[model samples]
Target: MSPHAPVLLNEVLEALAPQAGDVIIDATFGAGGYTRAILKTGATVIALDRDPTVQPHADAVANDYPQTFRLIRTPFSGLAEAFAQSGEAKLDGVVFDIGVSSMQLDQAERGFSFMRDGPLDMRMSDEGVTAADIVNAWDHGPMAHIFKLYGDERQSGRVATAILRRRVERPFERTLDLAEVVEKALGGRRGAPIHPATRVFQALRIAVNDELGELRAGLEAAEATLAPGGRLAVVTFHSLEDRIVKAFLTERTGNAPGGSRHAPTAVETRKPSFTLTFKGAREAGEAETVGNPRARSAKLRAAVRTDAAPWGRIAA
Candidate 1:
C-alpha cells in the first residue's frame, strides 16, 4: 500500500472512472497517491499543490509516468489557470482530497497536529500568515469566531480568552505550548477521546491557509474547467468541508430552493451547470476505515458537468 494512503481511494476512482486519452487533475496532489492511481488508468494527469514539500513525491510520479503526469506548484484554487497553461481546453476529470494530508501531520515542523511538538507555523504553502501569527496577534473576537466557525469548537470564546491571557506573558511560538494552554483552558482533556486542542488546531490551520475560501474557489474553477460530461470527485474529511461541497453540488445541480409560498423567491435563475453523480456523499467502507483511521471521517461527493456553460458565463 502507498504510504500516502489516500482516503476514499476506491470511491474516488469509481467516481472519476478515468480512461485512455482522458485528461484529469488531481487538485490536491499530496504524496501523489491519487495521481499515480489515475495515471495507471492511462489518463493524463495534471496535479496541483501549493506546498513546496510535495515536489519530491511529485518527482517520483513524474519519473515513472513521465509522459502522462505533470505537477504544478499552485493551490487547487488555481486549477483553471494551470489547465489553461497546459494548452488543454478543458478537463475530463478532477479529484480533490481535501484538507491536510497525513504527510503534513507527520512532519512536526508543519505544525498541523497538536500531537507533535513543533513551531506554531501551519501554512500549507511557504508563504502567508501562520497559526502563530493568528494566535499571537489577532484579537479575541476574531480568533474566537474562527475557532467556532472553522473548527466548530463550542468553547471557542473561552479558548480564545485563555490564549489572550497566556500570550501576554509570551507569544505562542510552539505547537505544544499553545496546545498546553488550550488543554488547561478546556480543563485538561476531561477524559476526552481526543486532545483538547484538536479543534483549535484545526481551526488555526484552516484560517492560516484560507482553506474554506480556497475550497470554494477550487470548486468554481473545476466547474469552469471541466468539459461537458466531465466528472468531479471531492473527498472531504470534516463537516465544514463536506457542507461546502454538498451545498455547491446541490446548487449547481439545480436543486436550489424554489422558495415556499409565504416567502416567494427566485430559485437559481441560471442553467444547471452540473449534475450530481450520486444522490449523496459516499463514505469509506469499514475495511478501509479500520486500516486507515483518517478514512473514517471521509466523505466523497461527485458530479458530472453538463453541456451548459458555467454560471456567470454566457453560453456560446
Candidate 2:
C-alpha cells in the first residue's frame, strides 16, 4: 500500500509550534505521519482514530517512541472523556486532519473513492452501519437531503430518486454499481474533470460516518480539553467543514455580533479564547499540492485557548 501523505505538513507544524515534553493530541491519526513528526519534537502524543485499521500504524510507532506515544481507538469526538480517563491534565496542542484519509481512499476495500471499485462500505469505524445501508435502505427524502447538503450536488433529487428506484430491484452492494447508477442519472459527463458520482459518494460517506456531527463534537471536546495557551490546528477539505471551524473560532473569540454594548466594540475586551494564528485560511503550497493532489482542497485553521469559558453562554 502506498504511504499516506499528511497535507500541509509545514503549516501544521508551524501552527502547532510543538515543544519538548508537551502533551499533544493527534486527533485523526491516519498513517501516523503527523504523530511521528510531533513525536520527533520530543512531545508526548495521544493519537486517536475511529478506524481500527490505524491501530497497527499506532502500534508500530509505539515500538519506536515507547511511552512517548499512545493510540486511542475511538472517535476524536470523544476526546475529552478519553483524555480525562487517560489522566491527562491538559493538552499542549491538538491537530485535526479532517475529511477522508488518503489511506482509506487508497484501500479499495474501504470504498471511499469511485476511482477504485470495491464494496460500498464507507463506515470509518468498521463496526458501524455501512454506506451500503444508507444508499440501499434510506428513504428518498433523507437520501436526497444527503446528496444535496453533504455532496452539494444540484441534481440530488434526481440522483436520489434513481438510487431508490434501482435499489428496489436489487440492493446496491458494490462501489462501481452505485457509481454506475449515479453516472447514468447524470447522463455521463463527457470530459468533466471529476467523476459524476463523486458528490454522491462523498454524501454517502459523510452520512454513514456522521462526519459533520463528529467534527462539531470533536471541536467542542478539543476546546474543553485544551489548556490555556494551548493551540488547536484543524485542516479541513470541504467548505461545509471549514464553515463550522470558522464559525467555532469566530464565536469562541467573540468576533461575532454582540461583542460590546458600547463604544461600537472596536476591539474585543475579554481576551479572545483563541487569537487567530493566521490571517485567513491557509492552503497547501504549490509543492505540497503537486506532490499530493488531495491537498488541493485542504484549508488549515489554528487558534489558542483562552482562560475564559468561551462556550458558557452558547451551551446554555
How does each model score on TM-score?
0.95, 0.94
lDDT of 1 by residue, 228-274 (tens): 99999999999988888888887788897767667654445568899
Error of 2 at 12 (Å): 0.8
Error of 2 at 90 (Å): 2.4
Q: How well is each residue in 1-316 modelled by candidate 2, as lDDT tens digits?
A: 4379999888999999998989999999989999999999999999989898887888889999997888888887788877887777768999999989877988899988888889999989978889898987889999999899999999999998999899889999899999999999998978999899999999988888989888888988888789999999999999989998998888777777765466555335555677788767999888888989999999999998888764632221
What is the alpha-carbon RMSD of candidate 1 to the true structure?
A: 2.8
Taking all chains together, the TM-score of candidate 1 against the true structure is: 0.95
Task: For model 2, state the Cα shift of residue 122 in Å.
Answer: 0.2
Give the local distance difference test score of model 1: 0.90
TM-score top scorer: 1
Candidate 2 pairs with clashing backbones: none
